[model samples]
Target: MTQHRKRDKNLGLAELVAIALGGMVGGGIFTILGISVSMIGNLTPIAIIIGGLIASLAAYSYVKLGLYYKDEGATYSFFKRTYPKSHFSAAAIGWFIIFGYISTLALYAYTFSSYAISSTEFANDIQIRKMIAIGVIGIFTLINVLSVKGMGKIEDLMVYTKLVILTIIAVVLIQHGSTSFEGFIGDMAMDAKNSSTLSILIVASITFVAYEGFQLVINAVSEMTNPDKNIPRAIYSAIGLAVLIYVVISMGALFAIPSEDIIKNKEFALAAGAGDVLGKMGTDLVILGAILATSSAISGTVFGSSRQMSVVAKDGYLPKWLAIRKKNIPINSIVGMGVMAAILILIGGLELILEFGSITFLLVSLLMAIANYKLRDKTNSSKVLTTFSILGLAIGGVLILYYEFTAKWEQMLAIVVLYAVLALGAWIYSKKNERAKKIT
Candidate 1:
């Protein structure tokens, strides 16, 4: 208890929201912008809003469970504790959530690499982008392994600075608009006239990945004060702010740039669009914003996900070595996640990994909704909303899978293979621990 209290002394509401925003506003918006705009045109902001609503539905359960469990393990801990008898349940959720984080890690690092090279000769070089992604992951992993306090302070600076930069970039793009706001609206109406509602929902489902990191707040429960009040406040506030930022940025991009450019330079779409519309200054600002956003995201993710990985390992859901810590920092887990993310960067492209991350989080959050609904009385979770959350996320998860199957079947196959491997490893450890317990 004293140790836990000591940890909490270093964090407050500001740090907590910073972590949540850092985890969220990373590569998601940058990557999703091109895809969303390509498919939905000017209605991209609507998709982002729908995405945020889905995120809030997901957050409803997480906040309730976080207040009740207050465990650093977060998703894994909440589910495992709620169903203590189910080893498979614990193992699967642990594997899924950890890998989900890895996928987002890959997503953010890839986006960072993309913007980092948008102006260079190497902008189209896949190999160079992968190398840069691995390098950024290495840098953030080291930062996380060094000191928790140091990581928190750096995250605060990164998150706040990026917010300012992004806001400025949005305003500049809006001010330098190539098309009138009314013209953009007319284009959206035409686009919507030809598009189906299902397509819009599918895009929203894909964009849900942009809101993925808000749960990083729950992982910091042990390091926060007033868990009950602050957990909800921070998570809700972060998600709300993320939605607004995403919409404004999308609107700015659409008003200033053509949809064709957004899709053609999809990897570094925003920076490319800004360069064309606002020239070098606009391009540089967008690049800087992307750098800060992805940098803070990588740092916050390494900080929170590593701790959660440590907790899963402690429960025998993963290799015991991953649980090893120094000065309360999950050094081994941080290195492990970084290494895996780097491997993913080498193996998968941005869109493939982005979809996988979205699907994994949707499933995990759906599970969280189920868990919260089961313990609704204890957690004071609203039965109606929790049920809706479950249904919403379930639909979101299925929609992404359906989108992948219809559009990118190969990526879907790879995701399935990846899940199989994770499940097999989880099952082995789970069974091993259970049998050892019986023998003892």
Candidate 2:
């Protein structure tokens, strides 16, 4: 494909919202919700609520960063320019964050595989699972190879469809589902503090997962009609709806199955949520929602990751070839990112991938809070709310790290190792650049 293929422009508020909703509300929700309740027992809904607040705090930081920098790379470019010494750290972190989407991709691939295998009318064939996964990835890769506009339109449609699907499942569950509260809250072995903290952290992390797509909206800052205003608006709108949906779904899951059942069988998470209410059909619908949601997330990441690559190229951080834009799109970067993402789906384990990505994003969120503080002071604006927004992120980042370090230890360790490797990579890249300069 031609190197830099530009489209008409970036995107607008409507497109941005589609990207956010489409990206964030994916396989994680359907798969993780039941497990969460299983872990915390009856406190699952409260955990989701706690998670939602933390995620929103993080989202607020992104909103300010998007407003201040308004660049193509979103946080990576913004942080790099703001903290030049941390450029490579910025790039490495960016790589990690992309893995969140990569994890989602792997998850969807698995779900598709299961669905394809079960669809065999004659008999239940487990072998077909792998076949379906391979085919879905191949198909998704091809669609990604198309123009960015093609990807965006597909993301918008798929995400909305997923939402519709989720809504239908939810409604059916409400009407037909049955589970009393006392039964919903099962006897989980735990002390008060440990149980409460775990529940809170798990829920918080899951809610954060739901906000994953919001960063994607800002990635297309250059395309927005009024990025400064609309991007923030889009971020808020998408996150708001997501939190609402998650809360309701958590409640539904609690009511659908006994808390002990949720813990014992995680795969039955969504099925339990819809089983009594929507019957077998409702169960299938949630699963379908998960598949569609992952598709949306992958689409968002493909577009956003490529744009970050272009932003770095524009700054001379990487080869200008990567920055090449043809027909208004960075063809080189898009394909490069798509290829990398596809490879990741085949290899990197999801938890490790998510941690690595989360670390980078956490750092970016840290910088964003600082940037907002810097900008607010620099501009001397009266947007009191935005000022507090930055403050919340600063505190939120610390709590997130504490939770991640404790809850995701192995993944966190992997992240630290990867950080060292990326640090070495930046060193090599810099030395080569210095040598090239001396030769001239």
Candidate 3:
């Protein structure tokens, strides 16, 4: 009985929400804000809200499918099980989703390092920033490998504490802002008139990456209690909260800082701007919030994505060694993810990593939406919403691609090449799995 109790659910609603929020809020807003403001000016908040709504549509399908499948593998497992005969579908999604998580992991670690040294003399040193980013990944990888419950508790602490810091930073910035509410509204009107619809929509589509972490809750289905109730609860709640947090913080930044300054110091805009308004103290607060935000995100991503990686490896879609687990924890997968993310950071620029992650997740989520739409009856999902999800995600995917093609064809070519490689690897694994099955 004691053993049974010990083996029972280890995560609750709060922890689940934290994991989702941790994943969602991690470097997303910090990384996207300057770009969004650069593209749409004061209209960035509107784009962010639209992005959140699109994310909600994506979440509807994820929540429905999660409850129905209840697989800790979440995205990859759902597709694999839903279409049991399609080895390629399973293998492809497994590869894409794991690499998508790897990209975000690198994004978070890079963002963490960016803010960690934003105020220091080393702020301009790219090499030092990359080293710090890799170091932070190593720290969180160790934390995740140590114990699941400990990771959960640490996540809860970091996520909630960061929320408080972020909220305070928002309020403080708003209070000391140069632009009044009326002036801010005027600027929004002016920017809305000047910005093209496609540009605004493109910004909205780009902001979807910021909303990517809510699905991490679904990946924790095994560890959480009453997943049927908590899955939707934690996911929806986190996304909603994320949308609110992002909007508030963006509004505060717009009010306090000039758009050009934000665009100029895109990497650490908040810290750069806060120093002028809130002085050194305000900058410190912003840096602290960013560090905590990205830290929890790294922890949650490592926790959830490693589990999915293990699940995929166990099914022979990835290297077999990644399947090894110690005490139900995917220790090897966690370490492998850290190493891969570090290598990505070493080789890929920030923009490349960010765009790759956004494109991969959007494509994968679009596929998941289609799967849920097809399995609507079993998942008890709304066909109308599922269809909407499919359309919305499809549109988002296309918009990002269009943006890429028009703005940076070279990056688009690189992304295409990467996809080709991933597809080839997936095909090889699927073929191997088929032959083994036939032999058996």
Please write out the lDDT profile of model 3 over residues 220-302, one tens digit for every residue: 77789988799999999999999999999999899999999999888899999889998999999999999999999999999
The lDDT for every candidate, in the order shown, is 0.91, 0.62, 0.92
For model 2, how does the per-residue alpha-carbon lDDT over 10-34 read when each residue is reduced to its tens digit?
Answer: 4677778888887667655655665
Which residue ranges in model 2 land beyond 4 Å of their true spot? 1-7, 85-87, 98-138, 181-194, 264-268, 272-277, 314-321, 379-411, 430-440
lDDT of 1 by residue, 164-214 (tens): 999988888888988888898899899899888888999999999999988
Lowest summed lDDT window (length 10), candidate 2: 115-124
TM-score of model 1 (CA atoms): 0.98
TM-scores across all candidates?
Answer: 0.98, 0.82, 0.98
Preferred candidate (lDDT higher): 1 or 2 = 1
Better of 2 and 3 by lDDT: 3
The regions of model 3 sitting more than 4 angstroms off are 1-6
| TM-score of candidate 2 against the unseen true structure | 0.82
Tell me the lDDT of model 1 at 276. Answer: 89
Error of 3 at 62 (Å): 0.6
